[model samples]
Target: MSDRPKTPTLDRVHLPSDLKALSDAELHRVADELRAETISAVSETGGHLGAGLGVVELTVAIHSVFDTPRDRLIWDVSHQCYPHKILTGRRDRIRTLRQKDGLSGFTKRSESPYDPFGAAHSSTSISAALGFAMARELGGAPDPALGDAIAVIGDGAMSAGMAYEAMNNAGHLGKRLIVILNDNEMSIAPPVGAMSSYLSRLYAEGPFQELKAAAKGAVSLLPPPFQEGARRAKEMLKGMAVGGTLFEELGFSYIGPLDGHDLDQLLSVLRTVKARATGPILIHAVTKKGKGYGPAEQAADRGHGVSKFDMITGEQKKAPSNAPSYTKVFAQSLTEEAERDDRVVAVTAAMPDGTGLDLFAERFPRRCFDVGIAEQHGVTFAAGLAAGGMKPFAAIYSTFLQRGYDQVVHDVAIQRLPVRFAIDRAGLVGADGATHAGSYDIAYLSNLPGFTVMAAADEAELKHMVATAVAHDAGPIAFRFPRGEGVGVEMPERGEVLEIGKGRVVREGSGVAILSFGARLKEVMEAVEALGARGISPTVADARFAKPLDRELILRLAAEHEALITIEEGAVGGFGSHVAQLLAEEGVFDSGLKYRSMTLPDIFIDQASPGDMYAVAGLNAGDIEAKVLQALGVERLESRRA
Candidate 1:
């Protein structure tokens, strides 16, 4: 903060309205200052630095050319909205990005009018923007007005089929929509899929570029001086049967493969499009992911997501962890399993690094698959692999797994394809917020018939679950683990396969029992210690599998204990709900047993530290203690603190 850079041109603008007052030259200066400001701000609050740096000029140009808030500007994924936040009215709070109760890392509709559509997930902006565009034609939101709808999507986002679906519908509806494809040749990882290859070829060679334009057949849309020559060129290409660009064939005007970093080009094209666009239009702009930032540009992944770092040396100030990250543990366990079983393979949906499957890919290149951003395809593909006698572990984030639920249910669960699911980020993720939180996987997966759902209490348990999944081929089985480092514990030489639907007594006590699931066992132990101070020793048990409930152990606990509490880092209708159903069915509730379930509250948590988010969810140690105390009918002074 002491070395906060001065933003001269950016300092003058409070909002997009102020941007309109500046000359084109001044706007260029603004873009420069904006980049400085973005780097400085993200240096202090590290989150999605490269993407924001990539979109500085585009953000400035769009704001300068279009009347935003009213025009409904939607950013696909919205991770690059940091520059937009600064250009809009939130510049003052730029440094507070992704902190507790601070500005969110992603766009939230309620946070500002500028973010008309909230998005942290990718490829959704086009669909949302098209909705706004169609709404304008059909008398959408405003009392007397409906303006233009523009979506600035990434080249990576284009890989998703959802983008095409929206474009197809937008083409059919024929609304005046503007779609900016920010082609940086990268997403979180390197871009893949047909769309990326097509975009890459669009700018690779001279003949390809010229032929691409001719293929688009946009002669009249060309400049006046080149129109006649372009028309002759287009006629030749038409005879060659390279009719038009994919976008043009889909009923939208295709423009560019333009220079996104050049303010002059971006501003000129935006203004021209604003003035003349009729139906849907695609503006392809090529730019570097970490533009104007030396450290970010040099780093692998283009410093996509970062930790708070030094401005001079881009050295991240990440705190040291006591143990390997849960992601790393999963990778290690899976690698060992793969070594044992040649039939084992890994599949990830665009998150090879994040899921730690990149390591697996290194060890077993032929066995690992990176499916790009297509989760649905990845899920079904894994199912097909399983059907072909391969033990395919689909390693995907819990939040992202929601996208492939239909495939998971239909192709895997219903068919009992035995596609093992390695669900990462199974609880409230800190800075990435609720959009990325793995809060509902337990509920969603457990409810599926013939599906086995397990939660890891610690790193050792995760290894066992990985082994258990490898051994099981009865049906679709899944195990969820939270983000961040595991609680430090002794490393096991190899994972032992555990019996399905079993519970293990971690600590035995008398009056009350706490059935903990997932990584909440650490907090449960802390809660037990706190309760111990009050002379209220409680029994703690780890309920490994939620789908096949441990009826004997749970019923025994219910019958013996005065009260039993279930705690999990998931929503309602998860392990707790299943236990409740089991208790009611077994007539355990008839004995007047006090039962309580501690789960995440019915609300989306905002970006914050993991501790702060857990506090908000009322699932922290103190909250767990209160639930335990309340269940046992103990009148405690500390309950007020919780």
Candidate 2:
């Protein structure tokens, strides 16, 4: 309790409406208290710490100035919305961030009216805000009576093509919209590409701080009497300052590279823009990632995503690991493969650290590519690399790879280019929730013609799959692995490339066969042991290749066992579906064989521990055991429900 920051000013303000009653001086204090409160809350229940911390004053100012809930405020990649949530009547539940049935870490429309649009993915806010603005003009939602549509986007998100797409459309429409480009100059990893460089130059030039405030509004937006003066001032400012011209060309009235930490500047600028803006406007506010927190500021990622940490010391309390994380293992394996083969090159979409490609980059600097949140381009780029006689490993998260599906199909699959896709976070990820869950890659990628899809059953299997992906140069190949630690199995000294379209049996048993895909083999083994207690020992086999189908192994399993159950940490139309199709085609089901496919439910599961999430998906050991009992027509006296 003593560790909790003193938030007396924050305690008085329950919502944005309550903030209206406070004076400007009190508002400044409120911003301070809000930052403190956000830090304290996140310290207890760790989440996106630095991004939220960066936007503290900006959040307070926006809510204070705007009539929120009516005025739609959309946060780009909303990981930074924790401070916004705290100010908008959710301070009481702030500590419950990212837990099961608790307040989501990102902005959720279902969670609060204050959250006008839900987003976890980056560069979406501008597009969503434009829609809202268009809707307001067309009288779409008359109930709340939409006032102004505002999108607060980060500079990192600006690197994506989608942000520019929205900007181009918004510029064409010429609607009265507000876009606050929160230029902290950092995304999860230090932002890359031309956008980062452009923003740096925008703020880095000569002293135009004096001319900036005077040229806030577009010349056409000002009164006729003041129009000429404003025009002259803008022209003078443009010559002296390197800022505003790029946005101006895009048909937006650009204002500032103002200090985002300054509440006074934020409030002043927002108030003026809200009162007098005539067309699309963009306010560039410069902020420091992990502002006001020494430890986070000192850290490389700016404390991007953290576990529960000490409030004062900023030391995270991580549980002791029994095994190396799947991410680290993948990195080590990829690095080793890169050593053997100089042709091996890596690519990531602004997720070098997350995908463990940072290690790859450190060893082979020139060979690695960080494409700066442009997944579509990254995929095509990897395809081009493959076409030019290089083994390109596009290491992307399963969920994010969806963005580049068309490129994967057209450029890689159709061209028969050998692009090795190291798909990370291959299952229901914890905390960051449904938006980030890597559920659909198995289904999406497996369905593609000439694409080879494999899921690693364990860390050792992951190593072998990496080796396999590097060796196979016929077509595009992908291997998926989950987010957490390995199953604590003994690892191989070196990965041996396995033959394609084959599977290995883990434990041989009778009556039923449990053909497992991905990391679920660990859970399947546990269920096998529990089934042993029930005198029902089921055969367990790891289906290494999902696309190739492992036809012989699957058919034999179906023929030998009374019932064949296929389990995978993926959605429907994946490994299980492929196996089912193979069985139906082979006439195995007609031979009195009962077949069941256990997969992730159709609905999107929310944030929780990965174990809890899989439990909800009904893919746990108990769920597997119950499923086997049901499949074999063997009733158990003990309730599996409990």
Candidate 3:
């Protein structure tokens, strides 16, 4: 299209090999073109923008210097892989990112040979790279043959323990592996903890870049005759500047604090390392998250994730909504709770903004804790707070909470600590795809002894649940809500504490009953409306507590209704499974009552709009109504179209 950037240099490049033919000067031109193309593409497709923008020059330098596909290149969290994708034969579909049947926002092994390993989570790249290196050593090669393994990981990702764990093992193995620490001084939120500070000190202590900072171990890269002089020169320079002693201690050679945007500098360092490095080596390349674009650099998150936008102005084309998002509602409600109770505290794992803990942090900075990317530490830390006589609300995304399950089970549930878990992104989150969905928390939490699990039907219910979690200091409690805007309901002045293990009947009827466990209650109501048109009014109830199972309501519904259907916004092992088990144990099934459970299918759903994903799961209103009819053995409905 005419709106697309003029990328004369990038247009000539269809694969990594194409960059090999270009001069270093021409390669710089390609970097500029690639940046422009990335901005243009993300402005249309509405995916990760700044991460890719930051790495434009790095992308060009790597592809030009190294043999990719054969040499496995891994991107930690892979949100920055957009530029890499555009250069590797996927530019034709670059504009279709994160859409249904489109190219994924993150790297996927199935997508292309360029992407050897896929990940959306952070800090796994070094481990994966070491695996590739070991595979190469063991003569276990796939087609095209594995050569070198290079991990381009962010400093934000370095906060996680896994990165260090991999480094430790890699050092012990003594394999030839390369690690590029892409330091942008930012993750999704500004990185927290000692790692960020440690990296800052490395460059801040002195003019290390001016010294052309390379580790003392770089002397080992020299030829035998030149090694003595190079060692002497390295020792002189090392005394003048700070070195990465921490990395060197971990059993790897550390080099850099290089200007990541300078293509010539990147190429020089990379070429040297590629030719001469033995064993695991670390290259610290400092970058800016939003390197080129003016608007992106100015934004708070550096325009980390964006919707389609006006290309020139960089004004996002977001659909306006009157209803407050579930995240905001939770934050506001929690803040209100904190006002009443001094002991109330909040915790998040490197996602204060995503979990809406940013609002809480603004109000109660001391009480709000961001534990960086360490979910296990965050969970256990929250448990310790509870044990210390403080009410800790660990607001984490459903997918991320999975990482802390062992802690949740041991530190909280087993000990009966009153650590409140506020699980955001509780369902199939659109655009981010299955990797980020909150589908297993219900099953996982509910099964644990003395754990209280709840799912809110709407924002109002979420507020009430927050209050309930505050009031009930019995055991480990969790309440899950979906990702986007809540259904527009009348606002409550304050949250109310509801009775534990109780459910509310939204509408009462006769032959069939629909039991909803979460946000899917809205869709159930819609299905109920449609069913009423056919002169079949089914009873609809919101089962507030999934763990306690609302036994009385469930049993009463089973006794009165001919057919009962349970619906939830989770995997098959969650709410519906609990209800089925209860019925089976209670002998309700022997009485010839028709029962059905609706849940997200066994397969991981791909990225699409929320509506489309729900449709695929067969959990939408039409599907619900159809399911009701199927359960009741009602073949047809009266048509209003005639």
Candidate 4:
């Protein structure tokens, strides 16, 4: 530990109001302090570090210029909001970030008034800000004196259609809104698309700034009668040359490729924009992803997000575990499969590294497609690839896939395309919290007409599931796995494609049957062992497929067992719900069966360790055992050995 106070400058300010009190030079000092605090805080807790570091100065400048609670600062994807959190009354609680009953990793509206619009998914800031902007006008509070709506979005997020949709609306409406395009030249991975190239060019040339000023200067010099005509001509010339050609066509006054790291320059540019009179203006601020921290700066992905590490050495603190991560297992399996089948290709929505497709990309660069933060596009694009007789695996986080739900349903599922969805982080993602938790995918996808949803209980099962997904050609198939390492199970040398909709009995018992789905089966197994020690034998079955429920196996369990408990790593409407519906249809409840559906409770679970979060949700071994005992209507056992 350095002698310097933890979050020194950040600790002093409690709200955006406090930030508004600082001078330009003081704000710069505050930004430096904020960067140090953010880096240190993330180093301790382990979270999205590089993005937050990159936006430290921007965070300070924005809060200083805007009245947050009133102005509504909507962060596109709150991955970069650690500094925002520190400045806005969360400095002390910063260390508790992503822990259960602690601060959320993303901007949450319910968490604070300062975070007007909460976002975990990318490309939503512009839409959210536009909503706030429209609401402000409709509420009869349109006066510039009141406040303005601003959206700080990343260039990577800009690749999504929603960002463009919001930009289109904002431009056409000519609303008094400011959109600060925080171009870090990266999302999780390096950005893709023509827009990315365009932004990069603009940042390098600085033509947008020169042209805007010259156009204004030229218009001002024209005689009174010719002024309007010159203004129109200048607009035309600008449309031809620079003046927000993309945004202007959509209806915005585009400004800058400003240096986001330069505090004075940022403050000056922001102040100028704040003073300007008309329409939606976009200030493009070019920033390096990992600005202050050397270790993060040197990292290939700019320490995008990290585990806890040594502050001085920047070496991650390793928690000794025998198992590999589900991500690693998936990557290994996919790479192995691709090696065998050259037709297999991988795609990610600006999250190649996060989804563990980076290894595959390295091995087969020509086959990997990084579609930027455009999940919808990525899904449809994969559908296109699949249509062309290629095995396109759309690797995306479970939470992010929600953005492409329509595309999945209409483009792939309806069309019966074989788009393999490698859904990573399918359950409660710890530090990132609700924004990143893949709680809804199971329920949502299960409801889809032709969707195949599978959950891996362990590393070996994940390999089998990967093989199964690759082999399936009937329709879309999705396999979900948790965030952390897999259980210490021996990995198979070669994956075996299991029969779809078929489940296997892991443990044989008579009194109770626990239909475990996904990785939560480990907890179910533990509960079973505990129950056995208490002279209460329970059967454990791994329901490999959530959508195509194993009716035969489930029916057999219902007929034989005293009670059936369905456990999944998702929310209410998913596997548990499907199981309940099946039992109800089969008249399994006619005998008045004792049943309990264990799913994530209907609330946004906060950031915590995965184990802690699961414990809170009563999905841990102890919790599972307790729930089973309660369902059995039995008193607490003194000892499992009894």
Top-scoring candidate (lDDT): 3
**Clashes in candidate 3: how many?**
0
Give the clashing residue pairs of candidate 1, or none.
none
C-alpha-based local distance difference test score of model 1: 0.90
User: CA lDDT of each candidate?
Assistant: 0.90, 0.91, 0.91, 0.85
lDDT of 2 by residue, 310-351 (tens): 888999999999999999999999999999999999999999
Candidate 3: C-alpha RMSD after superposition: 2.2
Model 4: lowest-lDDT 10 consecutive positions: 212-221
Put down candidate 3 lDDT per residue, 1-642, tens digits, no spaces.
998889888899999999999999899999999999999999998988999999999999899889998999999999999999999999999988999989989999888989999999999999999999999998887676789999999999999989999999999998899999999999999999999998987777554554444432245555789879866665576556665368878888878778889898788788888898889999889999989999899989998999999889999999999799999999999999999999999999999999999999999999999999999999999999999999999999999999999999999999999999999999999898988988899999999999999999999999999999999899999999998899999879999999999999999999999999999999999999999998899999999999887999999999999999999999889989999999999999999999999999999999998899999999999999999998877764324333
Q: Tens digits of per-residue lDDT for model 4 on 185-266?
A: 8888888899988877664544445654454322333457977886676566555554445766787766666778888777
Q: What root-mean-square deviation over C-alphas does model 2 reach?
A: 2.2
Give the residue spans of candidate 3 off by over 4 A. 213-227, 232-244, 636-642
Q: For model 4, how many clashes? A: 7
Pick out the ten consecutive residues of candidate 2 with the lowest summed lDDT: 213-222
lDDT of each residue in 211-306, candidate 1, tens digit only: 544434234457789878876775465335433468877887777667788787777678778888888999988989999989999998998999
Each model's backbone clash number: 0, 0, 0, 7
